[model samples]
Target chain A: MSERSPKKTDTMTEAERDAYHAEKMKKKKAARDKILATKTEERGLVIVHTGRGKGKSTAAFGMVFRAIGHGFNVGIVQFVKGKWGTGERDVLEKFPEQVTIRAMGEGFTWDTQDRQRDLAAARSAWDAAKAMIADETYKLVLLDELNICLRYDYLPLDEVVETLRNKPRDTHVIVTGRNAKDELIEIADLVTEMTEIKHPFRAGVKAQAGIEF
Target chain B: MSERSPKKTDTMTEAERDAYHAEKMKKKKAARDKILATKTEERGLVIVHTGRGKGKSTAAFGMVFRAIGHGFNVGIVQFVKGKWGTGERDVLEKFPEQVTIRAMGEGFTWDTQDRQRDLAAARSAWDAAKAMIADETYKLVLLDELNICLRYDYLPLDEVVETLRNKPRDTHVIVTGRNAKDELIEIADLVTEMTEIKHPFRAGVKAQAGIEF
Candidate 1:
């Protein structure tokens, strides 16, 4: 897989390649136009990012960055990663007015052994999330690691699903964590399960500061 | 779910909550420290992003952005998407010293009808990718939509796999596209299949400029 083959351009004339590429692009444009014409609606979305892979929260943060790039205000509530100082948090916090980030969790459930305490934190975080959902000012609300909290039974699943269901029609909401509940998945407008095929952790690679965070 | 439940905090004194939280965090820190102690290796990764849903390329770009935040040089070779002007490309291009981007393909197979031309483009893109991989200056190399090119038989699967196998040890490479070849997946260090449960396209929402591009 490591060796490079010779360039194929030597065999084809410039004019021949140009003519072929043009004709090809023409057909593609027509097919694309037909598909684009059929798509016409726009609204808020209930997007759930869950899986055993590494990019669930990373992807959610990417969306937050993307939304901010579009000059949209975003609210981020961390459900299980409050203790770690992440690179994304540092970058996002630079935009004070456009981004509001509240690190609510003490840590993961296994780390915080007290069920009662975990439950309290989850409740408080969910309350904050609901407030953001109701606030029309926020274009996107990210519930970071909410799925893990739900999986641990720290928060009631039914209530969480219902609140997501009733969020403002124009405010996109993103929930990210592993082991997303079936109930939440059912109500989500877009659900992505990031299946992990390989992990560096198993190969003895410790989590890096910027990459893992 | 829309209604707020009574705060459980009402039953516990502030002092009690603080003590409980402090105790729980202490235990968590110990567990986390234990896990962190055993993880010690650091090496580059062969990452693959594929599936039916969106975010394959978005996630790859997110990593590139994250890497750049850490002052790492990155090379991006787009194998299938060159016609559209993307927001990520615009943003990444601002950092000329840290990032090198090559948009090689005219479009996808549907857009470019010439199989021979597509093959030539894929080969050219692969050559660019090999150059980046061999150059130790690049910390990460992203082959955007290379999987699609391989899937469509525009590039040889074995050759691509062999090339990836021989890349620099500390240089990470990410390949993004749906329907990745099994051979690539077999040798990848990490693979994520972004399963799509729901999409706005199905609801008649057209791909918006900043959001989609």
Candidate 2:
């Protein structure tokens, strides 16, 4: 065997190690204080839900219910899907002022033959979303099916990111849809991937009310 | 001459109503067909970053980044904190897979404090959150605070919703922090709550890291 030289290890000196440890300790203390101080200040929560998997909107609705239970005002703006046999419309409509709902009735891209109308509706929705973000009237804001708009070129991704980045310090925003872009993910504090493994559709089933709808 | 009550207008018969509706056709037939044919098809989205908030889980990171660029996953789950201090954390320690991050931490509650440990430790993080709710293996789940043990009597309210509720049909889960509960919001699909709100403490502030330890 060709004589392989012994591997070398980089070791820190005592002084270097001590300094490093001290720095780490400092960071730890800072973090602890931050956690302690966080109890008093108000901040924003941003959510982005997207993927080929099912139940994205359903998940959002669950959070909405939880937030409401905790006494929070919520706002939902449906980007591409407006009218259909959706259970969300039925249930949310019945809620008190604790929740506000808005939708773009143009439906999906292929349905809205007029490109201008789709773009205009998206712009209008964006304007409303901007207002909500600025006003802080609602504790939570849900942008339902918004990712589709970004993917379909209905709304500029840049503007969406900019708005979210500068949104009110206390209002929470949730963006949901498939084909989420990378730019939006960069600015976000958390990210998740929903990879489709198995689906009931492959077995030939139908969308049912109160479950799939 | 007195004001008369308004007369009832003519009402449409069943046949008339059917006729009126018969003329109105759905605009996007093919898309509707596609949507109708697949029972388990994914259409829409939701972000659930339900996990421990402090000690740097960054539940919303992956989702926010994905929305900013093309080809990114989107989701979030802030399980614990209901308050602030994540802004700086969001600015740092970003991962490509994270899209959106939202955390809710309000420090530790004392009355129910453990006699064994005074400060929080990462190793014991999972203990506080209700298992099914804080499990972050989903596309998004951010158990923010959750450190109350049954002995502490900090967790309660209702049965855990379960991972099936808010979790994406396909994704990873993100569980953070201490005492997970029974009524843990298990069917969460996504779930999170602040465990340390209104924590008893002195007025002057100084957060130490590693051990408050």
Candidate 3:
């Protein structure tokens, strides 16, 4: 029997635990290697971050930042944020050669007031996005809040899906916003829903500069 | 009946849709402004990211990137990731004056297998975190994977909670890991559970360099 029951690990002697742990790791490594062997195909990923919580766009930008770390050319198309001077935008804009950001939305639909204008902005952003996707130099493209525009039916679903389906083999695309559609989820390789458990906003706390933006 | 149904927006004439949308936005803005009026108090927050999903640490680092955008001083204590040379670490470390990162933990429990050593590492990381919290210069502190230590009882829950409770009034602290304790969530001003809807690893996709790291 194994003496390294995680809960009772501290109770065991160091020598006893180390030997047991080492053997366990050996088995784990073997099993992992087998899995890795089967994972031979390597290509870009279609990632989605959604749900009614924070970090949907933030997490996508995190990936963009990581891509920047690797010296990868990146593109960001903000479908609804509309050049709001967000903190992420300020930092990312510093790397102009490595990153190109288009904040196309006037604001949320309510702020825009004109359905025609909102639709125009969405189309403009989508056009920018398609161009970026077609460019082989860009390794990663972030479609920030594209899901919101899709949720509101600003762009045709088929065109967007078709573009993603035909994206370059080595290009990675991340879509962020709440309420991702069924078709998008169906094609995504990874999806994370940031669920709000508690928010300071409900407790009468206003949004802060760096933390919220 | 109103003519600006979101799904039917493109079908309506520009004049008709603008009038309807404008009226709707006016009422919405009034209601929103009322809520904004009540949210007058401003202070730093205790934020927690936990769940069995991805993006807990990724989202936390995203905030770090945003903070860097504003030139806010940040301290990152990575309890379990160790010095794996993660992409976020490489990028954030570029701004040495603005950010200090400590990748303390050796590895996951299974990888280390030394219970005593893991305990020692956790204590060391916690000590560093406490020092960061006490230093008034740090505007934001990210306790990366601290919840995993707490979940495994490596560090006393009460001490962690107390330190966070007494953190500087304007110093925001973000704790990230899956299975966050209820006590931690209870005191947190903002809590988000990253729910995993889908993952590439499940489909035999290996972790990509910049995207996963």
Candidate 4:
């Protein structure tokens, strides 16, 4: 059997072919627009502020303000701190129902050193945070000062990633701490590196309240 | 009909009372000692370098370098940047397996007007980060520039808290950002707020490479 020559018998009128081409182009354009729209829409995000440069938490806080302005609920879980002077807490208290806050209860390691107790506190905080992840209530969750937990082996890095992965699709997480983990970067959609070439502290200036506290 | 009330018994010996008091004091002392030990010995901590001040991310990077010195894996994630123009990424590249770095695709809002696309990119980075949180392979996970996502409503906050709460008990997480939520302050084992008292940018000094990028 003669190999069926590629059938090429369709010789349409110019008008008909032009119409067909136009229709195809329209469909392609529509598809492209849809894809672009999808790509541009906000979904979920992970952010990191690191390096020697300052304003990491300030950036995070700015984002918090931004989210709140947009009417999203916020939650915060701080690890590695117990009781101390707090101005942020006072500000957050204004919107009590919209935000939930919890402390890790360890304070500064320099002051407290009960390993078992500290571990227990971290565990409890973890439990509360886990529940929040499972629930689809809040829009944002901030994990503050978590780096120290890993450095001291208070919590494992593997488990944290798993939980983050499994969180609701709309949830956004922001973590602030020195010494961020490599695994976090691999999975993060965005990462920023803050470098400090100079700091007031290096210039023999002390931390100033209301501005540097 | 000894109707009234039962008679009180106070027959403890002087020695017994002394023993009881001594024991109580001992317990109190033990508790205090335990707390001190945990503070210094447990020493689970993450530093927050934030404010209008400088050296926020630089401090974080210092921790990263220190952790690597101890033969640990590290992860770096940035929230508000679109490029890898700094040496941070270059250094991370040196240990490809040990370090992972990601950038926030939209850079800062000042530089880009495509909030929609920026949000989308932030979301993808967040999705990737979630996976890392769960993987349990990396010892450290650094979330960079996550604050912007929260501020812009690119990601929800409550969910972020949940992930931090549920992360592996052993895994360590570092969060960097500015204006961290008060809720985060409450739960953080350590909470440090960086306030910008003065900045070069405020004086119209443009961000310099190796310093502000």
Candidate 5:
């Protein structure tokens, strides 16, 4: 798609280039305008970010920043991250008026090695998640590491899908983690897989404070 | 990997669950600490976000938010997304002391249709990017949509890679866009390709505020 554009030329003067460029852009704009006219629907999305690479949660946090920028109320439920004192959490805590965060996790399953406790934690987080999604006051809800819970059947996948299917019309729900289930994917409006191209951890580089947390 | 963990069961009492969880967590912590002991290197990273999916810029902005929370000075240079008054821009502008945003794009290449203008804009943005990377005061520098410029040959790939390769040791450099150059990837400590599994645009859903902006 990028290669379709004409390459730079040294022979043309600045003024000449400007006129030619303007003409081409005009035609492109007309085509773009036609496409814009066809897009009339505006509804909240069921967004899923998954795969082996990073940024699944990071991107959702980015959406949180944008939502905060727009003065929209946001709710965050870290399903398994717990209270690691993440930088994002610290920053989010500063915006109490616009944000409501519930770090309702008791570490990973392997870390806890207790079934009832894991189920209790997942149920607690899911309850919080359902409340936030059902709440009309919030515009965005982020469920971090929800996929892992579903993958382990900590929470019923059908219940999660049903809740998302019947969410408030204008409330966006973002779920992030690796190995997202297929049923969730089928029901999602947007799904992105963050494929790992290169990773610093394999090179023995430790995670930094601001970047990783 | 999440599947390897044991599932929830109803038989265990709360006290038993706690004891088991504590014992397992202790062993897991010991193993984690041993691995962590080997990771001694700490320095700035050359991070690249590229692919055909959403959140390349969004995730970088998430990092920007985290950096800001940590009170790290940040610099942002938009190579192609000129000011249409993005939500993130509005938020970043509020923190004047910590962020320096330079929006030098002249719209999309098709919109401008001018090679010289594109080249000039790229040069200006690259100048700002290099300065931010070289400056010790800034801890993180985000070059948004820089991959598009490099893919189009608007900026010199070798020069950009060279600049990043020789950047200050403590300043993190994040370049985001689709189709990143191989040279940049070759030197980058982290690379993520955001693969598109499903997109709302395909369903004729227009971009909404606080989500797509």
Candidate 6:
């Protein structure tokens, strides 16, 4: 345990404040060092981005760019959102060798209004995703909106879980969408559910080009 | 509404699949044009990121980079986390002119274990945040981990809410943390909750440098 520093006030002199901050940071460093010493394992992860809130897919796209920053090859399979022209897709597509994207869905279920067609698209997307998972060449694969497919039973949950369970040891996979199945959550190494606390749509604010898409 | 395209099989000729995809995309373009026509209003937003999951702060950081891509100046105030060396901080700090960051907290409540000190830190951070909010030069201001400060009652909720409610019309504000207050959510333009579905820490996997921090 680290010792707590004395309270700081706005009236403190600059030198005094700096000295206090330095002392506090030293204690924090010691505590952090103790924790870091025990954590040494590194491996690929099965990450899930789910919930009824925005940014599940957006966050996954952010990770794609982060992974690219580290010079990792990436693959993206869109299971529900296929109609919109996203800025991320345009930017990522420019890196042909490092990125492979397959937008397989016609649209969301409500927009398409065709169960059989939605199922077909999901199956096709799943096929593409499985191939990416098996390939060690791609370090990260983002299965965008795959949870919608599973929630609607467009694809078998058991099979999807089994495939993810058998993914390459060093391949990270991120699945995004709302209503994620329990099985997928159970198998995922990291899962984030986006809760809808407040929404601009309710306030009559339309989604913007760069912000939303 | 657009009609659903007929299902295509893997056996379809390359040219046939291409033609089908092109036709579908054309219909999608028309539908999208209709929606885009109605979305003419543009203004600043009060966005909230809350939930018991990873990526709440990560997603907010992503937006900072995205805003930078559009040539917008960004200000970041870390209310609870200030001790760790985050990769984003290092990168964003390089662009000193475009990005201004003030990591104000000594640490989290559990780490600091001092209520009066925490309250003092929160007040100081809030003052800095209010200054950023009033500055017209910053297009986006991210109050990182602000929810934690509010959750602990370190600052007055009414004052924070009123300030955000009266923010500049064209300046966006993003507040990230878990256990967001209901009053803040009520006034927010967009709210996202990151639910913890799975966490690698629970599985004994250590947080990575670029990934977690």
Q: List model 1 lDDT by residue over B1-213, tens digit each.
A: 244356655577857865766676688778788888998977788889898876787777777767766778999899876532445655565568989988785645465566666677788888899999999999899998898888656777888899899989888899999998878987888888888877777778866644565
Per-candidate interface C-alpha RMSD?
A: 4.6, 17.1, 5.3, 21.0, 4.2, 8.1
Q: Mark the regions of model 6 whose C-alpha exceeds 4 Å error after superposition.
A: A1-41, A82-85, A90-98, A105-110, A113-120, B1-41, B65-71, B80-100, B105-128, B151-159
Model 1's chain A TM-score stands at 0.86
lDDT of 6 by residue, A1-213 (tens): 223235544568756765665566568768877877777778788899887778887777667666665667898998866433445555565467778998884744444555556667888889999999999998899998888787665788889999999999888899988877877878889988787866676555777644665
Residue pairs with colliding backbones in model 6 are A193-B195, A195-B193, A198-B191
Question: What DockQ, on C-alphas, does every prediction get?
Answer: 0.30, 0.06, 0.46, 0.02, 0.49, 0.20
Q: Chain B, TM-score, each prediction?
A: 0.85, 0.30, 0.90, 0.71, 0.86, 0.86
Docking class of 1: acceptable
Could you give the DockQ of candidate 6? 0.20
Residues forming the 10-long window of minimal summed lDDT in candidate 1 chain A: A1-10
lDDT by residue for model 2 (A11-35), tens: 6664564455455546766777677
Residues A96-155 of candidate 5 have per-residue lDDT tens digits of: 999998876574555556766777888999999999999999999999899988876679
TM-score of the B chain in model 4? Answer: 0.71
Give the per-residue lDDT digits (tens) of candidate 6, residues B1-213: 233235554566756655564566568768876766676678889999887788877777767766665667898898876522444555565467788988775645445555557777889999999999999999899999899888656789889999999999988999988888888888888888787766787666787644564
> Clash number for every model?
5, 123, 0, 135, 1, 3
Provide chain B's TM-score, model 5. 0.86
DockQ of candidate 3, scored on C-alphas against the true complex (2 decimals): 0.46
How would you encode candidate 3's per-residue C-alpha lDDT over A19-93 as one tens digit per residue?
766677678767877887877667898999999989887778778888888888998888876423467877887
Q: What's the TM-score of each model vs. the native?
A: 0.80, 0.46, 0.90, 0.43, 0.88, 0.72
Q: Which stretches of model 4 miss by more than 4 angstroms? A: A1-38, A82-85, B1-213
Best by lDDT: 5
- Model 1 bad stretches (over 4 Å): A1-35, A82-85, A105-109, B1-37, B82-85, B93-96, B105-109, B209-211
Error of 3 at B125 (Å): 0.7
lDDT, candidate 5, B103-162, per-residue tens: 875734556677677788888889988888889899899999899888766788879989
The residue-level lDDT of candidate 6 at B55 comes to 81
